[model samples]
Target: MRFLYSVAWWLALPLVLGRLWWRGRKEPGYRQHMAERFGFYGVRATNMPLIWVHAVSVGETRAAEPLIDALLRAYPAHGILLTHMTATGRETGRALFGKYGARVVQSFLPYDTGWMVGRFLRHFAPRLCVLMETEVWPNVMAQCARHGVPVVLANARLSQRSLAKARRLSALMMEAARRLTCVAAQTEADAVRIRQLGAPDVQVTGSIKFDVTPPSQMIAQGAMLRARIGPRKVLLCASTREGEETLILDALGGIDLGNSMVVIVPRHPQRFDEVASMIESRGYTLQRRSALGDKVVAPAVQILLGDSMGEMFAYYEACDVAFIGGSLLPLGGQNLIEACAVGKPVLIGPHTFNFSTVSDDAIEAGAARRVNDAQAMIDGACKLLRDDSERMRMGQQALAFARQHRGATARTMALLGPLIR
Candidate 1:
């Protein structure tokens, strides 16, 4: 199975490169790091007892923060190598760990071909390896196993959509799963699925995202941004996907915004200009976060576009209500935990299969509400905007819900400490 999988990947090399090239048209970072995918990193090589982690993208990179912090403290003598597949993840790692200088090394993870994976493993010589979330690559696992390196899958979850895909590739993924030293799952459901998929050591360690605290500087920035927003009811349509933004714009156009401000923060930075144009074409007065610089939102502007990156927490802090995107479409929803952590009431669409457990629990816990469509979302937002008492109650519930789910990091550390020791 491993041999066949490697052969298939080798055959698909052209298509993969083509896709990267296509994506690079929008995100230049994809084109700039083409050599890294082949394991051709010319950075300073180091052998300081490395503790390497592979976080695939921005979401996983952010979720791995608590574990990264734990790894740093648990073995102060060891240097950390943070590897990422996307440029955004690498940037996020730098933003999170840039202060460490030589103590933290950020690099791109090579593609999952045998030789590329082998080169990555050989170069890093990681004492301990951690993969964040659903990255079960066969060649990578096979290479790590051959090098006698123990790999741990931390903060992992498997939705039904993902599980169905896994089932089709069960043989390869099972081999990958068996190579793991241990699996730290986010929920019991995840544990059960992983066990059934052939992971030998699966434990429900919850989600490390619950342990993440908003940065203090970001909160201060949010306060300043709120001051600029000028006492208007702020509604954040955060991490919105492609089609979702159009729906949000139409919703805003139909509604009576009055003194309320709608902030549309698209999920991908590449789409910032596209969304900004959409806002302008819709005939609403727009104020971009990037252009705002030192200026405040003028009273004439009804839509404030969040065109920056790594500032979701600030956006959440500045808003009265947050409508998490992706849920409105079938994209499985973005993470809502951050908004709730900051004491903001959240509204998600009906399509939350990606975060079904978290969304269900949040709704049950009174931190969030589920709306069916754009109209419902608009209605929900407008209702919350006017009903201060209801929003306050939901915000309090959101805070408490977040607090109640906060021990995942500690529990994960307990399970992983022995392996590292």
Candidate 2:
């Protein structure tokens, strides 16, 4: 099966490269660093021992921030090698870790083939491989095993749907799971699901995301943005996926918003213009965050399009109520923890299989409310907007819930200590 999978990858190589090139039309980052994807890199290997972390994209990359900081502090003698698959992830790494200079190096993880991964392992010669949340590539795991490198799946999670999918590739997945030195899970449910897939040493270490501190600068910026927007109630629709925007817009149309404003930040940056068009086509006056600058938002603007990147905390801080997107359509859901962390009332839609445990717990803890559909989402947001006492109550609960979940990074560090030594 592994051989067949490798063969399939070889066969699909051209289409994959072609797709990358095609996607580069919209996201030019895909075109840059073409050699790195094939395990070729310009970065020279240093004599210092390195800890390699693979965070595939934005959410994973963000989740990795606290862990990366911990790793840097715990293993001062060792440099950190941050690997990402997406250009955005690479860019994010630069933005987050550029200050570390040569101490932290960024690269694209080569395509998941034995040959490619082997080259990556040889080049980095990392002391350990730490994969952030659901990045279990069979070839990468196999290569690390062959190279005798310890592999830890950090901040790991396995939803039932994902487990079922992994079960379909059990032969390969089991092999990969068994190779993992340790699996640090977000919740017990995640540990159970991961253990079911044959990971030998699965441990619940809570969620590292809970440990992410909202930057003080971002909070101040949010305050400035909020001041600029005047006293109108702000409803933030954050990390909204492709199709959810339309449903949200249509739902907002029926609501008597009066002086309230809706801020929609899409999940992917490439869709900024696409979402901008959607807002205008609906006849809603829109203002892009990028265009706002130091100017106050005009009263005529009913919608604020959060097209900028790396400012989610600012969005969370600026809003009175937040509706986490992706849940509205069957796309799991974006992280609500960030919103909760900033002490904002959160509204989410029905589907949240990706973040099932956290979502359910948030609802139970009174940090969030689950709405049935887009209409209910808007209605819930409006209701919260109107009821200051209830809204403030939920916000306080959110802050408390966030505070209660701290120290995952410390626990995770404790688990990794022995492995690294």
Candidate 3:
């Protein structure tokens, strides 16, 4: 299986490079780090027993925060090594783990090739490796297994589509899964799916993300922002992507809600400028969060361009309604739980495969509304805005729903305690 995995890696190298090149066209940092990963540059670390955690991007990194903190507290002697597959993930991890940078090292994960994985393993010498969510890299797993490192898939999930693909290549996936010490999945369905894909000792530990508690600073900031934004209808476009922003802006323009404000926050901080430009081109007076100069909300703006990081929770507090992005155009949607956590009425588009379970739960609980298209989003937002009573009711429902779903992190941590220790 290892030999076959190596062959698969060789065969897929060209396609991988090509995709990296394409992504580099939009994100230069991605290409830069991809090179570093393959070249094995700046891979060494201080001499200490290391625990490596691999989170693919920003969302995964955020989900891993509680687990990382717990690991640090539980094993203060062990050094932490965090690896991300995306540039944004690295940035977010650095920001989130700033004070602990000395103990927690954030870097790009090496490409999933035998040599690169071996180089990473040799440098880090991690006693335990935790792969957040479903970021399963065959070569990396194989190398960790070969080095006798205990690798656990923490907060793991396997969608039906992914499971089907893995089932077709059952031999390879099963071989990799066998090397994993344990698989802590997000749900029973996910655990079943993973077991079918060759993973051993699978356990349903729920989702660590559900345990995320918004920082107190964010709560205070949200309060101040709400006071400033006042009664004017505010629609928060959270974690919007490329084409989604245009559609959202167009919807906002068509809506007849008076004295309304729209806040657009792109998922990637790198796209702040582009999103700001898009807002300007659409003829909406844009006020950037940075330009507000300590103001939580600018009164002289129709569109508040949230171009900052680590402030989504703060913004959510100020918003009366939220349109969770990424789902508008089949990108599997961004997490809607953030808005719900703040008691904000949530809205989403038709596509939400990535967070299907959460989305379904929110909808069933009457905490979220799903729209068919841009026009429906506009109508939904306007309707939600006008009906303050309904809005408040939904917001309450959302907060309750979020609270009820909490404790997944504790469950996951309990499962990870033995392996990490």
Between candidates 1 and 3, the one scoring higher on lDDT is: 1
Worst 10 residues of 2 by lDDT: 39-48
Q: Which stretches of candidate 1 lie over 4 Å from their true place?
A: 43-45
Model 1 vs. true fold: TM: 0.97
What lDDT is reached at residue 65 by model 1?
A: 88
Worst 10-residue stretch by lDDT in candidate 1? 39-48
Tens-digit per-residue lDDT, 1-421, candidate 3:
7677788877988888898788787677677766557736564656668889998898999889888888888888987889998877887898888878578977788777888889878777888999998888788888887888889899887777777788788787877888888988887878888888767799887777767788888989877777767778888889998899888878777665577888888998778889889889978778888787656465667888888877889999888899999988978888888788888999999998778888888999999999999779878888888898999999999999989888777776677778764
Please give each candidate's TM-score: 0.97, 0.99, 0.90
Q: What is the clash tally of candidate 1?
A: 0
Model 3 spans > 4 angstroms off: 1-36, 39-45, 227-230, 295-300
Tens digits of per-residue lDDT for model 1 on 197-216? 89989999888898999899
Pairs that collide, model 3: none
RMSD of each: 1.3, 0.9, 2.7
Tens digits of per-residue lDDT for model 2 on 1-421? 8888888998999999999999999999999989989988766756679999999999999999999999998888999999999988998888888888888988899888899989989898998899999999999988998999999999998899999999999999999899999999999999999999999999999999999999899999999999999999999999999889989988888787897999999999999999999999989998999999999999999999998888999999999999999999898887899999999999999999999999999999999999999999998888899999999999999999999999999999998888784
Weakest 10 consecutive residues, lDDT, candidate 3? Answer: 39-48
Model 3 residue 189 CA deviation (Å) reads 1.7
Per TM-score, the best of the predicted structures is 2
